[model samples]
Target: MEFLLTVLASAVGGVAAGLIVARLTRGNMTGGLLGGMIGAMAAHFTLYPSGEQALPGLLVATLQGAVGGAALGLAAGFMMKKKT
Candidate 1:
């Protein structure tokens, strides 16, 4: 169940990134978290849709997932800000 574990870890990473980014940016926590979750899942599958178990691929995928999650989280945060 390495694949399952990998996805789970990625999901957890996404949640953590979402919460941290939301808190740091003072954004909508719920929106940012949801965006991060979706972005991470997309990154994970987009990188490894074939389910390859290569170490390098996994590393790259995970890194990209985190980046994607962060990007989405940041976007969500910014969108939540008032137009002051």
Candidate 2:
């Protein structure tokens, strides 16, 4: 249950952050969400320290997740050969 909550929280936070970042970066929200989810999963597995839950707060986790998501999104965007 805790793990589920962590993933859910991270995913939601990441999606929201991704949306905001994408808008600011002149990118697409849909793709951003997907990338954000992936990033959130990665963060959940690798970034969170032992005994820490997802992150201290939504904003911090979201921001970090957003950074990762944006990176992935940008890479995807470049690979797709689409103009933003």
Candidate 3:
């Protein structure tokens, strides 16, 4: 249950960050979305703080996920952009 909740929170954070980055950068939304999900999931599993309470843990997970997502989304968007 807790793991599932953490995954869900991370995913939501990823999606939001992806959309925001895509909108802000005018980059590929699909790339942003995929990058965001990958980054968020990676961060959630690897970097999530240990031995924390429920709400705070989830919040921390979400924030880290968002930061990871935004970073990867930006990179992916930049790479996928068509040169014009």
Candidate 4:
């Protein structure tokens, strides 16, 4: 139950962060959102703090979402770039 809620929250956060980053950076929203979702999930599992691991406080979660969204957006940008 907790895990499911965490995932759902993270996914929603990821999507929101991704869309914001995409719009700000003029990148593809769909790609950024997908990448953000992956990164958010990865971060949640790998980098979450010890002990109180119940969805990470609002600030932490937002930070996580932003970091994940930014990282994914950057990756998407590089991948979408045309080789010259």
TM-score of each: 0.77, 0.61, 0.83, 0.69
- The global C-alpha lDDT for each of the candidates, from Candidate 1 onward, is 0.73, 0.62, 0.79, 0.67
Give every collision pair in model 4.
none
Question: lDDT tens digits, residues 44-72, model 1?
Answer: 77766877454234455566667778878
TM-score of 3: 0.83
- Quick one: best TM-score, which candidate? 3
Order the candidate numbers by TM-score, best to worst: 3, 1, 4, 2
Model 2 C-alpha lDDT per residue in residues 1-84, reported as the tens digit of each score: 655555577677667665566667666667666776776667766777664444446565555666666666554433444565
Top-lDDT candidate index: 3
For residue 48, model 4's alpha carbon misses the true position, in angstroms, by 4.6
Cα deviation at 53, candidate 3, in Å, is 11
Model 3 / residue 50 / CA error / Å: 8.6
lDDT, candidate 3, residue 60?
74
lDDT-superior candidate, 1 or 4: 1
Task: Look at candidate 2 and give me any clashing residue pairs.
Answer: none
Cα lDDT tens digits for candidate 3, 1-84: 787787888878987797689769999888899888988887776765452343336787688789889988888877888889
Looking at model 1, report the run of 10 residues with the lowest lDDT sum.
52-61
Name the weakest run of 10 consecutive residues (lDDT summed) in model 3. Answer: 48-57
